[model samples]
Target: MAIVTSKVAGHAPGQPRGGVVQMARDSWVVARRNLRRMTRIPEIVVFGLMQPVMFVLLFSYVMGGAIKVPGGGYREFLMAGIFTQTVAFAVEGASAGIADDMTKGLVDRFRSLPMARSAVLAGRTLADVVQSAFILLVLAMVALLVGWRVHQGILKALSAFLLLLLLGYAFSWIGALIGLSLRSPEAATSAGLIWLFPLTFLSNAFVPVNTMPGWLQAIAYWNPFSATVQACRKLFGNPGVDGAHAWPMQHPVAASTLWSLLILALFSWLSVRKYRNAVG
Candidate 1:
């Protein structure tokens, strides 16, 4: 009887277990569900894929030729900038999903189940990473067609790709915050575009920051998106904006990564707190 009782206790309901294993199990479920939904939605995939490609092709060929880099053509120098902006913008879809789920009461329904509270948020964010990765691959192919290549060998190239994905995930967290906090999907969508469009365009996405007015230059140089773009340019061995703005480009690979990680950590903390409060 005692031996049988011990076995039953070992498998008792609600018994605490491995944090990582639990997170993994929960994340897998979330990722699978989201991916399945994405696969069924052709329009979402097309738009997400098309926006980046169109921006790169149109801007690089039509407007890029006239905009000269200090030493050479501007098209090659600007690809990294465009990539950063595109990835950052991808966060909008993730934000929309979160807002949609909340508005539809799906999340509230999940709260009534016997699942981990952090699972949905963390898993959905990971799912966004997968989507961002696919977008990056497509963007890379486009860049290659446009004659952009990573001069760095396999290891550095992989690191650069990972950094870009991390940056995307971090921004996704910010999107999550907006999604969770906003009362309506329309408000969330409006706020995201309003906030992100200015942040992306005001930086060196197409033109060099030095060419802008002094105040604009200061803002652009300090912008985290600019830091990320400059870092990726170094990693890909592409020409940065200019010598005058070299300071932002210098050692950007590390600086941008640190900034990305910091922002992600902050957002994660806030999202978790907000979620727990809501649940309580």
Candidate 2:
């Protein structure tokens, strides 16, 4: 009887037990489910990729001539900014996805399951990260077609891409929290992007921070968005005006890393707490 009970419990002698490992496994399962839904709904991926590609063409052709980089061509300088903006804007899709799930009673369904409480939010954010990665890849191809090149070697370019993904992943947590707070997906999408307009445009994403007014330039230099953009510029060896003596612009890689980590840690905690409270 004891042997049968142990076997039924799945407590094999050499197998690892549950806890965080089980939570992660559950999260991956949920992530895969979300990915499958994205695949099934081809428009989601298609439209997501479209916005960035359009921006690349519009900026590279429409504004490319008007904007001047200090030492390099504007097309090369603009790719990092485009990459940063695209990934940062990924928060909209993340928030909308979560809010849609909530409205469809999917959260309630997941709550009824024997799964980790954090898995739902974690999985949603992970799936969004994957989506953002795909968008970045498509945008990169578009940028190359527009004559954007990474002057830095492959290693540095790869590091830049990693940083962009990390920033997007971190921002997705903020979206998760917003989605949990909102009742409808439409509301989440609007609310999610409300601040991002100023956040992305007011930063160095589309223009040189030095071109802005003195006070606005200060704010832009300190903006977390600017930090990542500047970091990518450094990594890709793209030409743009260097940041002033500001700490973030002066040491973009470290600043981007710290900012991303801080945002991820803070928002992940808040999102998980909000999810639990919402479900309860």
Candidate 3:
């Protein structure tokens, strides 16, 4: 009985460790694996590159003239909306990647291993941030070409960019959660876009919420996407027309940024908890 008890005690440590060091190690391994996958499939980068460009083009030329922005011209008005939509699309890559891994049974294999369970999510999330940042840079260049200027000076502009990136990172966690919970890549993709399309268009990103119907206006005003857009517009020093954009009716930048941080915290917690449970 004593020997059996001792052997059982010794076996306990053999189970996966769930501490910071182990998590860090696991995350590093996962990040490396993700980077390699990106390398092998350059299409991943291409897809990210193309999405924002298409959105900017589609909105600027196709919808820009049609859409009436209150304070600025169509290109100027289109910039905020385009940025919001672009970041929203980041979830596409995150969800798709996770679902693909799940489909390939790679995630199951990871579960069977005795590594830091959180590493998979951490690595994937970090990669998502990097990819999102790259996409943002591409979009920024395009915005410049299309006459969307950031008037907030270099320092403020950089800060705004960071905030936007953080927002994208938060949404990536949502993608990760959806990816793990869903059964198929196609299902994840569909779910992600369905969520994205409504969230973005309904907000003050492109057209002012005041232009929307009374009910939609209310929804758009409160939408986190609108907050982000309003905040970004403030940061960009864009002109504001009352009864048009609403909400950040004043300092949209600060309000939008605060909401983004809150969201990031919420989604990160949710994703981490879900990931641990899935691995366990």
Q: Which candidate is the best by lDDT?
A: 2
**lDDT, model 1, position 205:** 69
lDDT of 3 by residue, 87-172 (tens): 77778777888888888888888877888766787788888777778778888898899888878798877776776776787787
Q: Please write out the lDDT profile of model 2 over residues 1-280, one tens digit for every residue.
A: 5754654554454343458987899899999999999999989899888877888888888988999778888888888888998888778878998999899999999987768889998898889899988889888888888788887899999999999999999999999988998969999999998999899988888888888899999899889999999999998888984758999989999999999999999999999988888952
lDDT of 1 by residue, 12-78 (tens): 6675464878767876887788888888986877788898899888888788878867655676787
Task: Please report, in order, the local distance difference test score of every candidate based on alpha carbons.
Answer: 0.78, 0.88, 0.76
**Candidate 1 stretches greater than 4 Å from native:** 1-18, 241-248
- How many residue pairs clash (N, CA or C atoms closer than 3 angstroms) in each of the candidate models, in the order given? 0, 0, 3
Off by over 4 Å in 2: 1-18
Residue 80 deviation, candidate 3, in Å? 2.1
Cα lDDT over the full model 3: 0.76
Model 2 Cα shift for residue 133 (angstroms): 1.2
Deviation in Å, model 1, residue 91 alpha carbon: 1.9
